[model samples]
Target: MKQSSAKQYAFSDAEYEELRRIIEQSVGIALASGKRDLVYGRVSRRVRALGLSSFAEYLARLRKGDQAELEELVNAMTTNVTQFFRESHHFDYLRETFLPEMVQRHQRDRVIRIWSAGCSSGEEPYSIAVVMAEFLDAHPGWRAEIWATDVDGAILRQAEEGVYPMESLKDVSQERLRRFFLRGKGVNEGKVRVGKSLREIVQFQRVNLIQPWRIRQSFDAVFCRNVIIYFDRAHKKQVVEGFADHLAPKGHLFLGHSESLHGLTDRYQLIGKTIYRRRD
Candidate 1:
């Protein structure tokens, strides 16, 4: 349906409140007031696809506790906007400062682990992989691994496939593009695929930030950029504290340009713009 026709979707105030509660309980996104139209727009297709007549009926079915429907609901509401080397300074810091220090510290172990939480359709992790690949080319002995994860299964699948429209690589340099991606031709024209070397270094998985994480490894850096903005203050603090728990001592946490840890936690210190280091 057209956005202007969103009012025809039959969403009521009561139904909207129930959905807000469901989304917060299931996905940790706190949709504030004035987002009623947005919520209706995102879920209206699902309601129609399921052959439901109204938002009330959809909520009724969702109340039956169907896990699949719950997941679909979360997926519908989740936002996955992302791009390569976004907030370029983060990648620059990774290459110029963080990686060099990590290389020296892990000289004996020769392993570096990074987590790109809420990695969206894969740009962030892929960008990290490209930077790491370049670093590895020079060092020749170090190994790096990136855990790229998101709560949306559909987006996670896309992230794993590692394909993108050619236009998305606009910010990527020509040299780096040639080095890290295979240009598509013929049937796959106007597309690009991450090279084997870059793809091999990153692993994508489905993860919900509000829940207990099963990961056993500590990371040298955690990139949770532009993610926590969807969460409320309490949930945001929970997620940030969780990131700290999974970070190795002095490990860096990169947030979106507008995000900060100030007044949220004492576990990290601001080391740069939107960058925090675990306090020793």
Candidate 2:
């Protein structure tokens, strides 16, 4: 069912400025002028639901710190647009380069720890799991622990279920399709669900990367793709520095293709397409 077009709610100049400040303060994303359409398009539902006619009243309600109001605002601002294997280069690099090097160095443990830091609805992590599962199957003796996390609780819940429409798998390979997913039967035609083996391998949790991440054990790979784009320079630097602190020696950092660590930090060396390695 399509949601009706939201009521036209106008914002005073002061309210608009405050809204911009609130979003930037909370999530570190900068909103410039001409985003008024985006602002109204996103927040109009809030206005309608609250039966409020003005942005000022909505802002006033949010100021009271109503938990639901806060969550709605955050959800409205966050970009949850993601899909399975959206960036194939990162996966290819992982399979061809990163895994080979790790396999050679850590022959004894034969363990792989991968973190999908900004995992949205499980696609990134599930993609990682499928890759690792295939690699391990070919290698004869290896185990992997894949941790998938996001700040949004609602999306995390959807991810835990591991069910998706057929459209979501358009870019996925047939071999991976056969191995990691089950074709829905009965009332589930035209749908696919991740097989238990693949689903069980990924541990999903809610995490805000802006806060101090306390996972003391370092990761062999961290897929924080597309996440840093929303963060301002200082926040990006802080996140990257923190990532360097926790990343294992020689561990890989894979970011969004458009994002860059250039002038941001000297902690990692550029290796492949958008892939960075921890400095030894």
Residue 125: error of model 2 in Å? 0.8
- TM-scores for all candidates? 0.96, 0.91
Task: Give the range of the ten consecutive residues with the poorest summed lDDT in model 2.
Answer: 1-10
Query: Model 1: how far is 5 from its true place, Å?
Result: 8.5
Candidate with maximal lDDT: 1
lDDT of 2: 0.85
Q: Using alpha carbons, what is the TM-score of model 1? A: 0.96
Model 2 misplacement above 4 A: 1-7
Error of 2 at 43 (Å): 1.4
Q: Which candidate's TM-score is highest?
A: 1
Clashing pairs in 2: none
lDDT of 1 by residue, 129-161 (tens): 988888888898789999999999999899889
RMSD of 1: 2.4
Per-residue lDDT value at 184 in model 1: 96
Task: Report the Cα lDDT for residue 207, model 2.
Answer: 78
